[model samples]
Structures are given as structure tokens and as C-alpha cells.
Target: MRYFKGVLASERRIRCIEAEIERQQSRLALNGVEGGEQVSRTMEGDAMERGFVKLYDFCDALDTELIGYVEEREAARRTLDCLDDGDMVEVVYLRYFEGLRFPAILKLLNAGGRNMSERKMYSLHEQALCRLWRVIPREHRQRKSVQ
Candidate 1:
């Protein structure tokens, strides 16, 4: 579950990196523009071409990683769906997808004025986890994640 949340964070990081890459590329493009008084030499053009190629390769790699993160997140959500209990599902989903802490989840779960104790909350969490492993099959649990 932690892995699922980490994948989301990695996606945000990839977006930031892509923005930086675009900024760098725009800077490079501005640099490529020849001054009105001067013409671009062959050697200078070649250098600019080489730099853009490297940037293109980097951008392609980042795009691939972003796709991988999206795929992994979907897979984790499917795994979470395997649980039979709605409350259990909510606990796992909120924990992983929303990145909420246990105390926060406890508050959310207790919103109906049920007045659940901390110990009971912990017990519910534990039971949910136990059921999660038993409910999800071996192969599903072994699926690889990019995070």
C-alpha cells in the first residue's frame, strides 16, 4: 500500500521534471536563434543539434516512467478491490490513495458518532490487513510495482 502512494508521489515528481525539461528546451531554442547581425556557423549548429538530441532522449525516458507509474497505480487499485469488506476497502483505499495517516483514518471512520476507541481502531486495521492478505491470491500479491 505504501508502494501505491509512493507511485503517486513519483508521478508528481516526474511532472515537475518534465516542466524543468521544457524550460531548458525553451532556453536552448532561444539560444539557437541567430542574432540579426550574425549568421549561424556549421559547428555552432551541430552543437545545438547534439544538445537537443540529448534533451529529447531524456524527455522520452521520463515519459516512459510516467506511463509506468500510472499503470502500477491502476494495478494496486485492482488489488485493493479484491477485498470483500467495504470498511476494509475504505481503510486501504484512504491509506494508500489519499495518503492519510492512521489517526486521520480513524477520525474519518468514526465520523458517525460511533465512538470507537483507539485500541478498537488498531484492531480493525489489523483485521483488515489480515483479511487483505488472505483474500488476495498469491500471484496478485506478487505483482511488481515501479515504485
Candidate 2:
């Protein structure tokens, strides 16, 4: 279950990194525009160089993070695949893969022609997690996260 949660956490981190990259790019764009205020050419060049270097570092970090995220997601997929119960798989998939909250998961399930309550979903989720832990091989259960 922690391993599965780590996948979601990795996704969140990736989004944050991407947002930071965008913010940096916008700052760089703003710096490129000539302003009425006088600024030395050397200072401006140095600032631009620093911005580019920061952007490069962010990109490199993003690439490294993405590779680890992909691996974690793939491992999660395989773990989910090991489950024999359909309902358990769906609940785990919706929670971990789809990143849905319990209420939303219950709503989705009820809408899909299955009658389910929040408590029931919670119970099912716990069972699913336990089953997942049992089904996964001991060596493969080790988590590998970039952060």
C-alpha cells in the first residue's frame, strides 16, 4: 500500500517540477523584455545565463524523476494484475491508479451498476491492500522511489 501511494506521490512531484519549470521559463521571458529602468549589459547577460542553467537543471531532474516514476507505475501495474478478485482490483485501481478519493470511488462504483456505500468501499479497500501485499513477491515488494 505504501508502494502504491508512492506512485501517486511521484506523480504529484512531477507536476510540481513541471510547474516550477514553467514558472522559471516565464521569468526568463519577462527578463528578456527591455525595461525603461537602466540595467547593465553584463549583469543582464549573467542573469540570463543563470536562468538558463537553472532551467537545464530542472529539466535534468525532471528526466531522472520521470524514469523512476515510470518504473514504479509499471511495478504497480504488475502488482495490481496479481489480484484474482475483480472488485478488489477495481477498488485498488481506482484508488491508486485513478487517484480517486473514497467518496468518489463509491460514487463511480454505484454509477457503474454496483450498489456500494462508503464504509463498504473502505472495507473493500483494506482487503484489497492486504491481498495485494500477499500476492506480490517478497523481493519485488521493495520500493524504489527517486525522492
Candidate 3:
């Protein structure tokens, strides 16, 4: 689950970065300068390109970040299939990937009769997160290892 969340987050980040790169590229293309002025403009364009390249590289790094989460999410899904129905998986996917809040999740769950407290809902969230963290790749772990 954590792995799945990490993948979703990484994908979202990648999309944002790509959009920024596209915006920058379009801006550079629209500069419309020529000759001597074009040389100076080209330098500025080069700088922007470098910046975009760096961001692209960062997006690539996210693939590494996503590796553990992918593996863990798959493993968890398999384990979960053995033990329970698909509801919890759906809830986790919607909350983490769709960015839905607890009240939203509660509304979605519609677990009737029992009055679910916000605190309890948050506790469930924490539990899911913990499970995710346990399964996330070493590289994707919150703290970086000292060199």
C-alpha cells in the first residue's frame, strides 16, 4: 500500500515537473530574437534548458524512489487477497492516490450503524501508512542513509 502510494505520488510529481518543462520550453521558443540578440537569448535559453534537464533527471530519479513502493504494494495486495475482501485496498487507493480526506472516505465507506469517530478514522489512516512504510523500498524510506 505504501509502495502504491509512493508510486502514485512519484507519478504525480513527474507530471507536474513535465508540465513545468513544457511551459519553459514553450516560453523559450516564443522568445523570437535573432542574430546578435539571438546569441545572448540563446545563452538564456541554454540555462533554461539545463534547468529543465535537471528537472527531467529528477523525474527519472523518482522511478528509483517508486521501485520499493511498487514491490511492496503488489506484495500487500497479494497478502490482502488471501485475508480479506477488496474494500480496504479500494479505500487506501482512493485516499492516497485520489487525495481524499477522512470525512470523504467515511462517506464513501458507508459503514452503517457504527458511529465512526474521526480519531478512529485517523488511526486507521496511520495504520495503513505504517504498513506502507514497512513495505516501501530502502531508497524510498523517509530518512536518507549517511554516506
TM-score for each model: 0.59, 0.81, 0.45
Highest-scoring model, lDDT: 2
Off by over 4 Å in 3: 1-4, 33-83, 109-147
In candidate 2, clashing pairs total 0
Please rank every candidate by lDDT, starting with the best: 2, 1, 3
> How well does model 3 score by local distance difference test?
0.59
Estimate, for each residue in 1-147, the C-alpha lDDT of model 2 and write its tens digit: 666778899999999999999988888879873333344569777787777779889999999999999998997889887778887888899998879988888898899788887888888888887778776657546554897
Alpha-carbon local distance difference test for all models? 0.71, 0.82, 0.59
Weakest ten-residue segment in model 2 by summed lDDT:
32-41
Model 2 gets an lDDT of: 0.82
Residue 108 C-alpha lDDT in model 3: 71
- In model 2, which runs have C-alpha deviations exceeding 4 angstroms? 33-41, 137-147
Candidate 1 clashes between residue pairs 3 or more apart in a chain or in different chains: none
* Least well predicted 10-residue stretch by lDDT in candidate 3: 32-41
* Backbone clashes under 3 angstroms, per model: 0, 0, 2
Clashing pairs in 3: 2-132, 3-69
- Residue-pair clashes, model 3: 2
Cα lDDT tens digits for candidate 1, 20-124: 777767767687643222435588766666666667787887988788878877867787666777777777787777778989988998997768777877776
